[model samples]
Target: MAATSHPINLEVDNETLAGTLLAPQQRMPGVLFVHGWGGSQARDMQRGRHIAGLGCVCLTFDMRGHEKTLQYRQSVTREQNLQDILAAYDRLIQHPATDPERIAVIGTSYGGYLAAILTALRPVRWLAMRVPALYWDEQWDTPKQQLERARLMEYRNSRVAPETNRALSACAAFSGDVLIVESEHDEHVPHATIMSYRAAFQRSHSMTHRIIDGADHSLSSERCQQAYTDILTSWVSEMVIGDRIGHLN
Candidate 1:
């Protein structure tokens, strides 16, 4: 089926975030796509469009400091990015075509980090994270100099940060379904961090953890990219849309 796509420009605080909305003719489950850090909405557009073709409403957007608003890169903060993410979620859920109760959030890398926090903050039914980046609240919110200095220090108790705790708490409280995609050769996110994320979702009614072999953090190759998109679309179609597509994970 053909899908319709719309350009979206969101006004968040002092900067503008670029986004796109894709939808089928009929209203269905809603899915929001959050791109990784240093990435734009375009990175997820193909997956969003394909999901829309499967009768789902999808929204994909560029976070602050990324894509069209590169000028804001220097000023955008972790807090600001969180605000942007919340605003984007609100926009998607409020749309006339979206069914708020059946919503899925898909994010990659840093975006996946936000998605993890969001599932706790909002009533997200389905959650998907790919190679989610890890950060401590203190380090993430600190100045670049301080953050760099802290990064260079010992790796003692990395998972005890306030923000990480909050996300883990949120995930623990969420009783929906979760899908975690890991890269076999991911250089940014470590296996330990991925395991931590998986552990956080202990309360999820269903969880699917899949790894794409020979794939980098970005799934740079065409073959890996196709696998990423297929895994995501196929799972959402089955769990969210109730279609017997095929096995995922």
Candidate 2:
């Protein structure tokens, strides 16, 4: 005798399956690299490419005073460079693959200074600063090249508090992870400035401080540059992995 055939309900909720499968693929972390004064996006391209390999959307742009805008180096104000950073950040997050909530900013020296202040204005998940320079709040609109070299040197040597400095104030309120890299022999950004930044991160979820031995502010030596790249890439890798794991949990 032939058995009666029963039809199996093979249909699935297409919407539910699509949501499950597409959610994770929809967005990725975004990393924005801001180069130091006198430096251009070319300086950060390699590092940005490395970070991008770790499943992130990376962006690197020349600030107003650098690269094609070299003529403005002597006239560009910190405010203008800050605006550059803000614009780059906005463009980075707007990318189709970028997850606006998972943003990382890496900056060196003057760029670091701007990145710190940017935290106060944007949503940043990770911040990495190398020899972040400190500046007086009094010269907000003055051309960077015109700032008094002597007084700027003196101010960098002195201890500063979060309340008195804009960057420090931003650091004080930041609740994300932070990476502060110092050069052992950095004359441009004194030890006092690094300490001030370190102290200002009162609310950071985690802070990692590193010192590249016998290095200058610029990391001019090849070894020093390689060391910085290693440190930064490792820290970023760890942070990205942790972020992914947290999402899974």
Backbone clashes for every candidate come to 0, 0
Q: How accurate locally, in lDDT, is each candidate?
A: 0.79, 0.83
TM-score of each: 0.89, 0.89
- Please give, for residues 57-154, the per-residue lDDT of candidate 2 as tens digits: 77777777565567778888998888777877877776677899999999999999999999999999999999999998998999999999899889
Residue 58, candidate 2: alpha-carbon lDDT: 74
Best by lDDT: 2
lDDT of 1 at 84: 87
Q: How far out, in Å, is residue 25 in model 2?
A: 8.4
